[model samples]
Target: MTRQMIIEPAGQAGLTAERVREVVAAHPAVAAHLGAADPGRLIVGGAAVTGRDAAGDAAGRAPFRASVFDPVANRGVELRGTVAAPERAEVAPSAWRPTPGPDELRAAAQILRADPRFPASGDVVVYQPMPPLADLERPDGTTTRRPTLGLYTPGEDVEHRIVAVDTAAGTVDWSPAGVSPAMHPGDCESHLPEPVESLRDRGGPDAVRLRVLDGGTELWNLIVVRPRASAPQNPGDGSGVELREVRHRGRLVFRQAHVPILNVQYEEDGVTFRDWQNQETRFSATGTDPVGWGWRICTRPPRTILERPDNDAGNFQGVAFHDAGGEVRIVSEIAAGWYRYVSEWRLADDGTVRPRFGFAGVRNPRTCMRHRHHVYWRFDFDVEGSDNDVIEQFDEVAPGVLKATPILRETSRRRRGTARFWQVTDAASGRGYRIVPGGHDNTADPYGIADLWFLRRRASELYDGNPDGDNRAMLDRFVDGEDIGRTNVVVWYAGHFRHDQNAPHPHQGHIVGPNLVPVR
Candidate 1:
């Protein structure tokens, strides 16, 4: 295994994104590849951290991954390396065709708009849909699946068709005629403005800390990671709000909380298109800034709450803490293609932690189509500390009775009729949190089988890591039957949501998750 280097300051400042990009561009391999590539068609994005498990060596050198895309040539090269010294850097073997980043998505849109064959007339809005690309059959009858981008018009009614924009070949093609015909005029307006290049920089503080209080009493404190700092190269590491060292009244509750695995699978007629959170397009988590789509501080009565006069840290993606109704809420929005995901966490004064995932659609045809959004959260509970933590599963045996089962080994289970909830407690003190399922937290299908997964904490198992759509919801692979009775444990909770245009909730905007009630 490549010993990952943690980017930190030892005696000097760590490498910045610009410095890493300079080193990568200067590498012999990258330089050679650029020699033959057209400068006009080249798109280079900022370097991003690659690994979460760092060696924390004295050098403070960190692994960085970047990409150079040749839209005209329809090819991309991924460069991974570390800048060890001012004059020395290392580049790993070049990996081909990484998922499209924000830059690539924009480039694909431009390519499609320039093509004479593109049929769009009015304002053409481009989006990176889940499974951003599509399978195309050439005139020779040979089939090829390339990374694709989608385009649509916001207000006007147009015949709905998937415009597969292959950025690599600089080609534009439409999906076969038999698919869904008209696009759904969604409820929410599409505001997917291009990501601000300045805000997407990866060179900044490792994490931002926030403290919540109800006038005088300290409710809780936490460390939240920005999009770039969350390490997008790692599986399940990118694309959501990440919180660490969450404490309630000085008591350690959650070591970490984030959604590393998000699957947005679409079924049009009989054709299935699988999309992942981390894989296709590197969707930037949005904030209420220039785009008006990120976090906000609001009162319990649905009014806007101002930031504390003394707490002028400026919002990181508009994340703010406001104690309303004895509870504090932190919500962040992520624009994945045309779908906007609202990741919210509510921490109550009484010690109840509610993590919610809300699904809303922008102006797109798929918004009215049938689809399933499966979200999985990896919760690292420390209770008081990291050691002596235990997980227990509770089931309703009778109409008014319940049964508790101590899970001794790593395993995967589903929520049936009697299966209720699970709890993670400190074995010594019996202080933990009960994970109660929410009403919208539906069951998993074969593609997403497990409702709950309990496993011993392993850094390698932090995420599924597999971006291939063919392997959907494989969290069960982490269940190797390892003993987890009396050691540090991690809980993987999966929530499934079905969105159909014809349903009562036609808009398909709903929140699904669990409530973490403190147990003393």
Candidate 2:
């Protein structure tokens, strides 16, 4: 009785990066932006493939999109077209400036070093402390985005200084490092890893396509895309390290899984920074390959591991995969202005899935400031296919007693201080997976809206909310109380990390997520 899924795999390969750029460059807006800019200042961000149409039907030729950001002009453009027809690519001006890609970041560092206000140091490392965010508007209604860079001397554990340079206005502002009074013992004093030059240039496979197996029995087939640095200015375009497909033991577990919204709100501070607010200003992965850019396959033992690129000083910074005995892990180190994000996915030999996100900061102005990191992971679970799936909420009502309720309609929920979790099962087969909260998973504040959200699957509703227009969580807007009984269900889980400078790990260098254990 299991209903067959109509949704096509989102991992379908798309156009080549070179072809995507050619298509994007042909658009008038892009051509003009390129023509006016100084050579090499224009950044062409990576392209993402969208496999389905808005109506949820398979697109014969999946469309691919690329973004172009002009640092000097402080403007961005997004172009879209199908792999089969790159010449017909459509283009639109972006409402917000795109995040500075690896190339742009390097260029920004050079600018910072040239300014007289910059500390005279030749051995300093540079990185973006946080993912680039929204535009700073002027009184005249003109908006501009300054490329911000963090500077730190190698091996120094002290707070770092930041430089925000407006390439368009030929102005620069430097903010020296400051430590919060809350800083104390156990607060992380590590600096962000310096950018590796050849890491972005190396190209081999664009994706990690694997059939995870143990002793000749296949556990799952996984296809993952590295986190995208920047996306279009569209509402739901900024998804991170996409889990294109996760099929466990021959049944589709997740048709698509990704964190589209990563919003940060500094508590009480006048300054706020958010990533993926729009399709723009999102952090791109570390590599340069279009399809598999910023992804690496870790080599075992004796060889340095690339999977742990966020390791402290004097550690390996190359590969992004690790063999953890029963599970294979994939990690992507994403650079924001002064902070580094570790986005990881682990597939076990026993059909377990662990998705993790870590927040780490280098020496920077806000390193010790209190803030909340809100990350929303979208799980498009298609148990045993798609249509017959049911959503069940589990709560411990009494000592060792659990109550389960079928979610009949779309709704937003919170943990509410109870041992609460959720399950997605196929009504026909009674097969499913339980989503268990991680130890560090915390409750959301008022700004985070809710901790959990269940909604009917909609191809158009990729992102939970837009971070650009508003800093508060917006996933609640998608819950219109639509029928969700026995149908494709998309589960949204939000992980809240409260960065209190006084607490241990003040830099917020910790990983948080959930475990997906199969219900056999």
Candidate 1 structure, TM-score to reference:
0.74
Best of the candidates, TM-score: 2
Per-residue lDDT for 443-512 in model 2, tens only? 8888788888989988657644454465566777788989999988899888888776678652234677
Error of 1 at 140 (Å): 15
Q: Please, what is the TM-score per model?
A: 0.74, 0.79
- Candidate 1 residue-wise lDDT, 314-347, digit = tens: 2244343345566666655555655666666787
lDDT for each candidate structure: 0.60, 0.62
| Alpha-carbon deviation at 451 in model 1, angstroms | 0.6
TM-score of 2: 0.79
Window of ten residues with lowest summed lDDT in model 1: 303-312
lDDT of 2: 0.62
For model 1, the superposed segments whose C-alpha errors exceed 4 Å read 1-16, 28-98, 117-120, 134-149, 153-158, 166-171, 174-207, 227-237, 267-321, 506-509
Clashes (N, CA, C under 3 Å) per candidate: 5, 22
